[model samples]
Target: MTKAIRSPALVVRAFNVEISRIQDQTSDPQTAAFRLQFWQDILKKIFVKEQVFQNIPANPIAQELFKVSSAYSLSKRHLEKLITSRRDLLQTKLFRNLEDIEKYADDSVSSIYYLLLSVANIANVHADHAASHLGKAQGLANILRSVHVANHHKTVFLPMDILMKNKVSQEMVLRGVNTDDMKNVAFEVASRANSHLEKARNISVPKLANQIFLPAIAVDSYLKKLQKNDFNVFDKQLQQTNALLPFSLYFKRVLNKY
Candidate 1:
């Protein structure tokens, strides 16, 4: 991102991170909903054109979000989707099926891309399409990556339909049981993510938007690593950071390709 958009982008991501972590930050459902509502209220204030600059929240993330929202004319719907989707997930922790997960991704992940594009002042349909697919890919990949940690908390984000189709039980996942059925579940989820990544790459986004899509490289790397391990989400190697990821991102950025 250029210096002009970098700070705003970071602010958006910061708000996302704060919202995404609300579930883990509190075990009580009401508490989580209340925290998310706090953000929703802040967003309402941020989007109010009359008092956006005058009545900024004391919270640092809200303050930055207020500035970003006002400067870029960011869509309140997109920002609200981020909060509402996470709040919905907080209430219904597990997805019913692949479609459910995709909807969640579209709301939680794709909204960030839409906001960033606004920051860059790019409004092409191709860019939005690419953002939509990449968001689903990254969102699915993130769930796969977090399976181990989520299992520790006795929480399973894997779609229940997939688990049922493979005859993998919630207890099996919670126990960290590695089995053929478990690997099959992982394979199906990873394949869906990979498919979305392919579609994202096939689309030609605006040249200026390539940097925004750099996350595609990281998503591609993770899917490849997951494949190499034979779709074993529990593989220890998957837990380690890929040392080459930074270089790969930069290389793609220089070529203006995501």
Candidate 2:
């Protein structure tokens, strides 16, 4: 939370949001791929030693990212992983199994943690371990929350394996079916996310990195609410924002717990 890293962290997060929204913003797969390529090319230029900032595109996010990357000696591979994962997601919208989703979470989510840790100069394995589990937890929770919207787009992000195991079909989800089978799938996915969150909390990370993991509280809160709603991913109550979340996060941050 020091002033030194505040701007860099914000820039990195802004970059993540931009990359994540590409799929939602573009209807054409080719357009999405092209946009992802633009990021990839930007990353390459950002990492180049000869002309570090000279050839950077006229994009604010790219420009700030280059500055942070140079200032903090951020990992090029970690930054590249973010774009590559999004590119892969563009190519394969549906996951085959829970493990596939976890891998996607690691690539798309954990890479952010890795970069943040680098910015904070934290090199502990324990911190990285916690970040890995936390990323999976947050990523899975995000997928659960997006079920309604993804279905509206005629796309299903629930793992195909889980859906098959629960006797739920993609069409069923796309049609916004609120059956017991769909609830079962949600329950299973939520349970997996909960397990990862528990594991993350069990680890001992550096105090400096605690703030970085505050998203855990949000993930934990959503899972609890999902359970209360009987694991219904399409619950209208789930769509409403938690007004107390800000207070909750502030309390946790004050307690030095993530």
Candidate 3:
């Protein structure tokens, strides 16, 4: 019953897990592409009212997603964008500037928030705007936290503009070399993320949509940590979630404050 009640959340969680699995487990691009295509096809089926699945989807996640689709008028484009962004990440794409990074965040992060809003039947323009910025903030903060691991995996999320301006080299980032330039670049990106977060907070969220922004509390905490660390991307401690993160998120959710 609990699982049935939270099927939408489960679907989102399962999709994210599959993405992580592709990144961590799959080595061949062709194989990864096939896997992503499979999910894409399944999503298409889910969107169609009569065609739930050509074959019964054995994957629990897909089943849950199908259930949610039946229950709510979920946006197919937003859900598809989530998968597309993950597919894009499979092929290396260097972010050219802050705009590039923001676009990526919007595609990868904002799309999910929009889907969540749709699940809650939130249609207000202001809530949508707030969710978009909040998604950016959360996405950027997440990348900031994973910089060390991503660098080690030869993945770069920092914008080229920031790296160039700060004279931070790709090799330096890939090898986890901590430098003043890297710190500066992190500082700029973190600053931009915080600005988006502030913008999100300033907007009035509808009472029904308040819980959708619960992730904001976590994003806010991460921004504060980055500030405390002087925006050091290589700080090992930054990888750790705040000790009180669960409690903080719970409190914020219960209080209906993002």
Candidate 4:
């Protein structure tokens, strides 16, 4: 499904339209102002962000999206961190261990969670809970998706606790062996991260789970596809279904009602 919009241009349009819709739903001047400023920041990040969109092959669509989005200075400091730290991240060798990996995590998508808040029409009172919950979900999903690629690069991502308990070594992970303890360690890392996710949802705020709704459902959809094909994300051969997002819209609606 993926929003029924495959082309990169259409995808950018879809995201812009969705942001506008969320803003209209908010209908508050404060929310409106924040939304405006927030998206302006996102657009800026789109072109300037080296981690996600850097090295994208030159194409008409890529040029258009980058041109339109990278127009302003990001308002949040962490969003600034994503921009400022772009050079540091390029030096992959520096992040050779778990501690370094967590720092990398903080640099990349954890900061993106800050941008997601900037764009969403969620309010101040709800901000803390909203951010924490949504961040953990997105962060976990990101870490899961990029696990293999990261390991290949000599950057460590598994929690320090899991690494210690399982007696796994950084060199072993980079070597890419799927040891039993390693698999268990990865699962434990995810499970512990989910526990943090649950903690973030403890508050009874309106539209609290809305941010994570689509991602959570996408995770389930991806997991099901993996099961059917006898594939796992860590194995790298299991690709996510394009239809995942379309079926996930229903779940998003339900969670938004939270």
Candidate 5:
């Protein structure tokens, strides 16, 4: 009853886009509270108009934002907080090593999981679990895919443990080339990614995320391509999707349909 008279559907769409953009920029848990705040604010702004949102019990995200902005959902205050957070994204550390990159990756993907959970609602317990894992997996994949691009942006993606375990040096790999070192590093990362994919397959994905799973599949396909491409990390390529993927992934997901 106290909502601002906007539509929840539209709020969802706009915030979803905003969240996607942020996901592209970085995946830091430090950013979760900020992201959580963003959705909560949007929900609050529409509270006056959206009877559902207005009366909906304050979830984890809403409660946190309220501490900062008792009236934040109103006027320029809320928007300013988001803008400030967005601006901070551009200046992440110049990763001289993989350790830093992995740290950043953790933050980046965790932010995504928290934000997604805040927006999406799933009645089925299975659906809830699947979407939760899948979203985090997708975010992690995005961070991995962006390894090279993140370099250009002054960040890194792979963990040092992976680099060391595979006998790849951060310096040589970071330099990038058609060299064996880079290929080795790619193989190592891809191997790690494959593990993630196997895990993804093991868990039932939510059919509800099928529409949203475009991003998740894109991540898996990207990792698979890197594998097929002989572990080339230089090319910031999109996933070469097999047509069968959508049909199969969706069919299984329907069973867990949220």
Candidate 6:
């Protein structure tokens, strides 16, 4: 990575860690709210002032983020949206509809894409549009992949409407039952993710900005494997990581495709 992009990369990694801590550890709504507020205030200091890096939160993650946010002028709204979604996840499990799932994906996933683009100083409208859809695709794909793990944790990330439409129940999902209905529901969700991936592929971005979406390669590969298996979320095949993923991503990056 270029010097200009490295700090932002570090910052984003740190930011994701902070989000994971809140989402994976925090169980109390009030506590989650307070933790999110702390990060929000630190981000406010970075984006609202030019030279407040020295005065930003002392937490290592926040401190690194402040440097990148100050350097690249990352959008405060995007950063805050990232926080807000993690906070909401403390209480939100089953999405009411596909649209609700899509919105959650946009706020939680696309927000990261937008910030990375900012760090790369990409201001092109087309790239941002593509990133938005790509983020949604990746986010949904993630939920599909993690169904078993989510179920083990007693949380269902699948949209309730889709599950109902397919005659799958929360009980079936939580118990890892591989009913036809569950497979149908998984197919619908994967189809939505595939659609978004297709849309993202149709957009044109400059070579420099393409690296930001290299993750799409892995997302695409994983989705294809899931599709090939008839949308069986519990199949050990789906759980295993693709061995070819690294080479595939490298080739895609070399070709400058997201």
Candidate 3's C-alpha runs over 4 A off are: 1-6, 52-54
The residue-by-residue lDDT of candidate 3 on 1-258, one tens digit each, is: 123325576577577677557766766777888888988998877776577454537987887777777778777787788778877877755678878768778988887778777777779999999988998888788777777876546777788888888888888888888888888888888889999999999999788677777878888888888788877778777787578998997787777888
Looking at model 4, residue 182 earns an lDDT score of 75
- Per-residue lDDT tens digits of candidate 6, residues 89-151? 776756888788889889988888888888888898988999989999998998898787876
> Counting only residues 3 or more apart in sequence or on different chains, how many pairs clash (N, Cα, C under 3 Å) in candidate 3?
0
For each of the candidates, give the backbone clash count: 0, 0, 0, 3, 13, 0
Predicted candidate 2 versus true structure: per-residue lDDT over 1-258, tens digit per residue: 667777888988899999999988988999999999989888888888866576888998999998888889999898888989989888898899889899999999999998899999999999999999999998899889998897656789999998999899888888889999899899989999999999999999999899888889999999999999999888899999999999999999899998
User: Each prediction's Cα RMSD?
Assistant: 1.0, 1.0, 2.3, 12.0, 9.0, 1.6
TM-scores for all candidates: the values are 0.98, 0.98, 0.92, 0.54, 0.52, 0.94
List residue ranges in candidate 6 displaced over 4 A. 1-3
The TM-score of predicted model 1 comes to 0.98
Error in Å for residue 194 of model 1: 0.6
Better of 2 and 3 by lDDT: 2
Q: Candidate 4 on 1-258: residue-level lDDT in tens? A: 122112332434344344435433553545655655554565555645463655444544444455334432323465445433433543333434344544555554445544443334334556545455545554555555666665544465556566668887767677776677776666654554455456555555545325423344554454445445443345655544466476557656654622
After superposition, the stretches of candidate 1 with alpha carbons farther than 4 Å from their true spots are 52-54
CA-lDDT, candidates in order: 0.90, 0.90, 0.79, 0.50, 0.49, 0.83
Candidate 6 global Cα RMSD: 1.6
Model 5: per-residue Cα lDDT over 226-250, one tens digit each: 7767777776554334677677556
Backbone clash pairs for candidate 4 read 1-243, 43-69, 44-70
* lDDT of residue 102 for candidate 5: 35
